[model samples]
Target: MDDTLREDQKLTVRAVLAREGRGFAEEIGLGRTNNPASLFGLLVTAVLVAPRGESSGPARAAHEVTNRWHTPADLAAASAQDVAKELGAAVEGVDRGDGDDSASDTAATLVALASAVSETWGGDLRGLREKAGHDPARERELLTALPGVDDGVVDVYFREVQPLWDEVAPFAGTRALRAAAALGLGESAEDLARYGNRPEKIGRLAGALARIDVEGSHDEVRRTAG
Candidate 1:
């Protein structure tokens, strides 16, 4: 948490990354985003790992199903093994992969995730959003009730939708915090995101920061460690 950012460079990075983050957000077309569905995608993607990482793991694990599942009801009705197969395909193509038979866990977790979403949120992700009432803490509480969504995934989902929720500088995982730290942005990506006029842009910025380390731009992050 030491502020290693030099005064001269700090202004430059802050301005540059902030602008870049907003542009990136626009490129991703999050300007007029739909609620619940987009948030659900974030939740699913977070289950596997970094969605923006170089590997296609996120695609196989979640993105492959995002367009397919569309809602908790969609996933809940599908066979659990079919849901698991998407992740199975994605993980197989990656390196230094997870050791366990995550496919099985993926199946069970996906089933449970979809079931919880269906029963609790009534298959409308917006219900949870409505219940959150713009409070990030409340949002986190609701998200944690889902099967696969933990603190990390909750942060991911909320931050991706932060443009609507009006929360500043959200991070998906600790690696992102460290990634920002390496760039002299400080240990807390949230704080750096707050420096920008549009804080939601930090969600994308956090992803970029975390990806740098995953691609070996910095020391490797032990992502699987709890």
Candidate 2:
């Protein structure tokens, strides 16, 4: 929608995608296909997985949870407390200290959001998909109705899922922001999202940002790259 990205921004995104595409594809078992649902799931899982630090354990745990319960309906049917407890149990060997609580919180939030989605949209992702046709505003409103889905989750969902449904503006986040900052394109996800317009641009931006190691601040990346 917005054609604001520069040539450098496009190159940065392309570079990142090239670096991380294989790993991400393998990690998510999507192979070479760029299906919207799978992409959406990966991004959503990333949010829940908490890539802030020591993500391998949490990422594995999140994958396990998704495999055990694939759809929003599966999550909606779960007991929040029980789901939390189950996630806490699942992460036992991988995580330490209060990590279990974080897992529990993530589980609870996911389940609650799923339940809300089910109640609002007939227990199917299609409901949201349908809304995308008539009114994006309503679609977003429905998406935000889920308890754990904040603006951050919404952004990820829209960007990753829209490709599956139809072309739309890219929704950037911390990952993209970090990448943009790394490339000297912008300082934050919001800026990058506003800048990226085309699908190629979005893909490239996401790819580049995904390559950055998720340690230290954007400034640290700049200093290290120098």
Candidate 3:
């Protein structure tokens, strides 16, 4: 009974990740960072610099962070100044439309993320997944404990990271959630699994659902399914 129940849940969230979550993730370049730890770093950095930071900033920061620190311990041990220097180097290559120096908070957040992950989960993101298993609530709790992570980053992570944590449902931000409702999938995580049983299928569905919100054509999904 439990196994069946879990599979059902997996199907719902995976569908959203694959279907509705991809384009949204890619628009912000969040999907390109494959390493789970790097993904976390990118999410943290993006949130820190939001409302002013460059759209490309997260990708640069993630790449620099993953490159500079080979291990969780390495990242955790880095001084704030070291983090700032690496992030500064990353920003130098990007066009920050406004030509603003917006990396300080991002640097601080990544440093906090590194310290938290290293201390709490031994720096192995996979271990955190293993600990959470397929339970979204537990994942939420653990992610919440991370020093610099917030609700927005958490939602984005759960949406774009289907490949790493396939069990988590894609959280279609405010816009996409409305589309999910239009498609008859309730706003809750479990309601999403009913859309598809396979993880890959679910991921595609997640991308598809998110596309609706983006395109402002909820009818497109209905037409496609037909």
Which candidate ranks first by TM-score, i.e. highest? 1
lDDT of 2: 0.53
Score every model by TM-score.
0.72, 0.63, 0.57
Badly placed stretches (over 4 Å) of model 3 are 1-54, 88-102, 178-226
Candidate 1 C-alpha lDDT tens digits along 1-226? 1265456435534433543333222333323355656666656666655334423455445666665787777888888666666555566443323444556667677778888888988876778878888567787888888787777666555556666666423543576676666655667754655545364556656655555656665432222110
lDDT of each: 0.59, 0.53, 0.56
Off by over 4 Å in 2: 1-15, 22-26, 30-58, 85-99, 132-137, 185-201, 207-226
Error of 2 at 53 (Å): 7.4
Candidate 3 local lDDT, residue 45: 44
Please tell me which model should have the higher lDDT, number 1 or number 2: 1
* Candidate 3 TM-score, C-alpha based: 0.57
Q: Give the CA lDDT, 0 to 100, for residue 124 in model 3.
A: 62
**191, model 3: CA deviation in Å?**
8.7
Stretches of candidate 1 off by over 4 Å are 1-32, 50-56, 92-100, 168-173, 219-226
List the candidates ranked by lDDT, beginning with the highest.
1, 3, 2
User: Of the candidates numbered 1 and 3, which has the greater TM-score value?
Assistant: 1
